[model samples]
Target: MKARPAFMLVGAAALTLAMGACSSSGGGTGATTPAAAPTTAAAPTAVTLTVWGPQEDQVDSTSWLPKQEAAFEAAHPEYKITWKNAVVSEGDAGKTVQQDPSAAADVYMFANDQLGTLVQAHAIGQLPPDAVAQVKQQNSDVMVTSVTGSDGNIYGVPYTANTWFLYYNSSKFTADDVKNLDSMLSKGKVAFPIDNSWYLASFYVGNGGTLFGPKGTDETAGIAFTGTQASDVTKYLTGLVKNKNFVNDANGAGLAGLQNGTIDAYFSGSWDAANVKKALGANEGAAQPPSYTLNGSPVQMKAFAGSKAVAFNPNAKNPQAAAKFAAFLGSTAAQQAHYDMRGIIPSDKSLASSASITADPVAVAQMNTVANASTLQPTVAKMGNFWDPTASFGKALLSGDITAANAADKTAAWNTALNS
Candidate 1:
């Protein structure tokens, strides 16, 4: 799901990108070697740098951003850090800067998918030589690909691999119960957003629906949104609305339910972990999204996994300082602090074995899910066409406004929405 494109090239790129597997690997981390580092510039300098991140969303949300800033300052006393109070979100940064470069933060936090747009507008700066080496050495190959642009230059440093997974009340779903979808639905109250395309696509992927062509990012490939496998899976998941235990948590009523003990489990990401723990305390548990029992067998779930990264503004006054700060923000110490203080699963591979991360149930599940089972979300401009249509289709199916008998017709309507 992405914001609509203002140009045709990005849309075409995204559609093509979605139709084929990426130049990297299928889904998350693979055994492949990292891409060779590109040529870069000189060292960062001593200057005032403005930084932006979603620290307000943390458990101790208020302090984590400042803590990182203070640490960054302590290490590089020549650079002064400025915290910009704003939303750490997907749609804001790229478009705003594309419109007016001067307004972009010296270093800013943005979702992985927005990389293409920012790069297109020339709003992001190329990484310095030291930063380039640090990124490849620190983060996984998958993350490096996510932040790299069409021009082949790496534009940012990754922090969190943003994706969804299962968060359950340990007391409600036993160890065995958390392994599959139907089992969880059969025994407990599970809240999921059947209307959100990003979340809804899991069912189709688990059941063999393919989006990008054979490899995943082939420009000549095509979308399988209404193909046989997708239709079959969509029909099957639509049938799940009949389950008495399922609740639509699209607008967060489900989060409330999970917190108040009314819901047994919920489907979400690290962003929701803090509140889930506050709600269930000792009972909070997490696992990869369970497979669905289909044709008397289980189908593994595939999700849209991605990174939340920091990039330097091409227009920043203290260009070198911003580049250094951007690199510093994704460093091991900062990532660990994010995990310890904010519950954000870091993109850095070295920090996985740390005691704080190892002890956290949510962090463990997230890492397992991304490294082993999840698929990378396509970050092309065509992603703009996905969200609203799929959400509308899912809602219509889940609410009983449409059925298998009319599913094809409904899909045709969904396509029309995509075209519009």
Candidate 2:
């Protein structure tokens, strides 16, 4: 399987407030008799901190969260972290929070793409200065350029280091048959999340193109489908479809095909490792996407990297404490714990050499591939609007609704929506 980029988009909020109310009465120093001294202060009433994220369900009941909760509780006896699992329907977690604000978890675990919307909604808050410093000291790389928002405030701490990978059911292909993209395709058709434009970006780049050209240096920075790049990318994709090597079933039926032994391979993200394991029943293999031959060398596919981080609710009652927890989650210990249970890669470079991760050949190889060949970029709200239309173009190309020459026109229509 080849790697494809996947974007997690969070909606921004409008306003954020601070909510901290004392839960206990203070004791007087001079008035009370010797027999009436304050007794243990009731353990600060055990504040329940709420947390939200799409990975909540992935946190194994016996393995991960319970241990983390116990550690956090032992460290901060006054706080009790409450996990609230939220669904990321339609690629956005904002809808989940919008449905209920108070019930919305105080801490949100969000995709890198959705940070903008969360910022706009004012649902996320800046971390405390000390906590930010601590996080910087704990995991500088993931924090340095990874979790910062557009406004220059730190919104979240990365909980999962995610990347895309190709997952294949070996039963569909013999050892000799699964050599390269063309060979794999020659054996059987491949499936992709055509509905997911971010995932499709890998296919675009694999053919020597990009969604947006080089950042900062190119005027097209933050723009999608500009230049002749998109046309070239579409042509390659059209060729794949025309050759009957790929199918476009945007509703995940294509993936279902691979799972059911109808297809050989599928493009999926690292986050889907567990799902793929379940689908393939422990007899699957994972690989990096095949490369396009450029200058006599096979240039591997450079897909998008998807990351999830924990952000504080600006309106939370315990900002400082929330910040502490956020920082703790990014620590190497916590990251390793998460990887142990979730199969996600760690953002911290130090953990790259950890025994738990290295013990698994598939994980080690995938992480190395991601580190060497991957691109990370933020996705705008409009990109969400572009997904369906772009997927429609993929379907058109696959179904012959439109010729390769006209793919630009279809893509241009999607770009128009993206820009709108």
Candidate 3:
């Protein structure tokens, strides 16, 4: 599913009132009728700090943006933050920003894939040193390393912590039926987006394969795959599709299936849980993707980690104020508030165990699973180019027209596209 970005800033009315009240209180009481309490000149109108993100069709104004904006404005009373809405119709945020710096917004919400591209292009500015230090002190466990660019400078503040989970129809499968892959397959059908190659990676990794070796290993650093491992993943995926164990619902067919009680499970991100629960009923069960056994123990799945972070445009008109606002966003209180308003998990380790997050039993269990499993590095500019190729290859593979060897060749074609 595509992500829709929403940006909101509380109006200056509250601040205006607060300033006015302060002025009146400080002024002499001799002036009856308040002698027009010196108009506390509106907080120095900082350069309109423009921020853009894809429009969210689902978020209600009262729920997500307004709340965040009110909190941000309340904390920073000296500057006016003007939020602009920009939608990315094609390519990623990095490419969109590079297309026109002036037209590009001062602040942008980018998915993980867009982060590297923005850093590589030098389109993003580093977090002010003081801001970084403050964030570190507040939440020590949130590694600044995750948001650091290839240039070894921090460019963004981690916002959303996303992972894939198995959203199944409770009406279709019982808890006992979903204990393992075999039982799941035997009991009900599974569905996911077939156009994305990452879905394939999720399945392969869930079954104990890695796109890259360990945490420190670079995915593009020429990691080799054994023939046996390749065959195993390919065979497992193909067999699932061929046996009608998994369904590719490219045309909302899966959702229809879900609504009709035909499909058993759907693999999707945590953000979709709310909608999934609404559709399947609150009583439905959610679980982490099943693990594949290696040796004697169950191995975890490899899922992509998508982060939504706030970054300043190097060409922002109000660099200092914008920087300050960005820093405020990374503050402990702000991070927790954001998480509370939206069901998004906070990147701050300090808030990771907070009651708001852990209070939801399902969310807590899924998060625990994520902590145990490794995450795939988010897509950057280079990886964005691979999305189409991977989707095409996956489509062909599902159609029974492409073999594992051909799919490998298709992957090579994707690499070539990235270079081009």
* TM agreement with the true structure for every prediction: 0.74, 0.68, 0.67
- Point out where model 3 deviates above 4 Å: 1-96, 99-105, 130-146, 171-179, 192-195, 206-220, 242-245, 293-297, 339-345, 349-352, 359-370, 377-389, 392-420
Residues 1-420 of candidate 3 have per-residue lDDT tens digits of 333233211334455556667657857453433233324446556557665654551155565444565677777777566665455521367788887766677777666456666776667778888877765664322234446666657777766555666678776777766556556777779777766766656555555444334431254642233344444555555565676677886776666677677777877667666666667786566776666443344445656654556777787777777677666666677677766665656666666578887666456545644555436554433445545766775787788766655645544454455345
User: What is the RMSD, in Å, between candidate 2 and the native fold over all Cα?
Assistant: 15.5
Q: What local distance difference test score does each model get?
A: 0.76, 0.61, 0.61
Best candidate, TM-score = 1
**Cα-based lDDT at residue 308, candidate 3:** 59
> What shift in Å separates residue 346 of candidate 3 from its native position after superposition?
3.5
- Consecutive 10-residue window with the lowest summed lDDT within model 2: 11-20
Winner by TM-score between candidate 2 and candidate 1: 1
- In angstroms, the error of model 2 at 283 is 4.3
**Per-residue lDDT tens digits of candidate 1, residues 147-204?**
7776678888988888889999999899789888799998899998888888887777
Q: Per-residue lDDT for 86 in model 3?
A: 55
